[model samples]
Target: MRHPTPDPPAPGQESVWDYPRPPRVEASDESVEVWVGGVRVASSTRTLRVLETSHPPTYYLPVDDVVPGALRPVDGATWCEFKGEAAYFDLVGGGTSAPRAAWSYPRPSRGFERLVGHVAVMPGAVDRCTVDGEVVVPQAGGFYGGWVTSRVVGPFKGEPGTWGW
Candidate 1:
């Protein structure tokens, strides 16, 4: 598939097409929050943002910032060539459960070690997710966990017909 033309980023905005290919992990000071089943399960200012070409930023929150007893380990795992193997977690809160709603790399690949001990949740699987107080739109398609906020512009990768991007 031909690369989609990137939308022009307005002032204070970023275009996902400008992100790196292998992906870059950097510290983020933005307030990241996750809610599930009407419960605020996680919130943190000290988070990591993973940026890759054609995808919106995916925020990884420190496990310590999550509410106690909210994440339960689950079976199955997936591998990311850039990050490493990820173990799944069932997010439980407010008497509701979202299976495999979250994941983390227990031992990340070199250069991506910052991902260790940090969790990324699927916004579509949970009730809501926010970045710096703004509700986020989940990246198109259900597989990737990129968080779409007003600060980012995209013809994001997960959209239909973008499989080969």
Candidate 2:
């Protein structure tokens, strides 16, 4: 299924339609925080976000900014045509765990080399994920890792009928 044309962007907002097809990665200085099981497992001022057409941005936190021992590698891998292979991780902190709640592309594709070793979490798998102090909503599908912030306007991809969009 496919979604209709994207909505227009209001002032101070960005339309997902303007994002790239192959995707682009940009460094972000905004504060991105992840809390799981009642504990802050990751907080970073330096992060990377991938912008792709029809999808909300996917923020990638450097491993250094994440709590030590907070991520445990899990068994399983997925491939992204644009980002290369991704490995999954469990968010293990505060005596709680969310399996395959995070992922990283150890050896990202050429254009996405900066993502190597940087982890992007599934917002739905954590208690909450915040960007610039605003709590984020997870992109609708369980498979995509995009984090939905108010700054982005979408009829975003990841919904039931948007898989082919």
Query: Using lDDT as the measure, which candidate wins?
Result: 1
Q: What C-alpha lDDT values do all the predictions have?
A: 0.95, 0.93
Candidate 1: TM-score? 0.99
In model 2, which range of ten residues has the least summed lDDT?
1-10
Candidate 2 C-alpha error for residue 28, in Å: 0.5
Please, what are the lDDT tens digits per residue for candidate 1 over residues 1-165? Answer: 789889999999999999998999999999999998899999999999999999999999999999999999999999998888999999999999999999999999999998988999999999999999999999999999999999999889898899999
Q: After superposition, which runs of candidate 1 have C-alpha atoms over 4 Å from their true positions?
A: none
What tens digits encode model 2's per-residue C-alpha lDDT throughout 74-113?
9999999999999999998789998999999999889899
Native-referenced Cα lDDT, model 1: 0.95
lDDT at residue 83 of model 1 (Cα atoms): 86
Worst 10 residues of 1 by lDDT: 154-163
Candidate 2: deviation at residue 30, Å?
A: 0.7
Clashes per candidate, residues 3 or more apart or on different chains? 0, 0
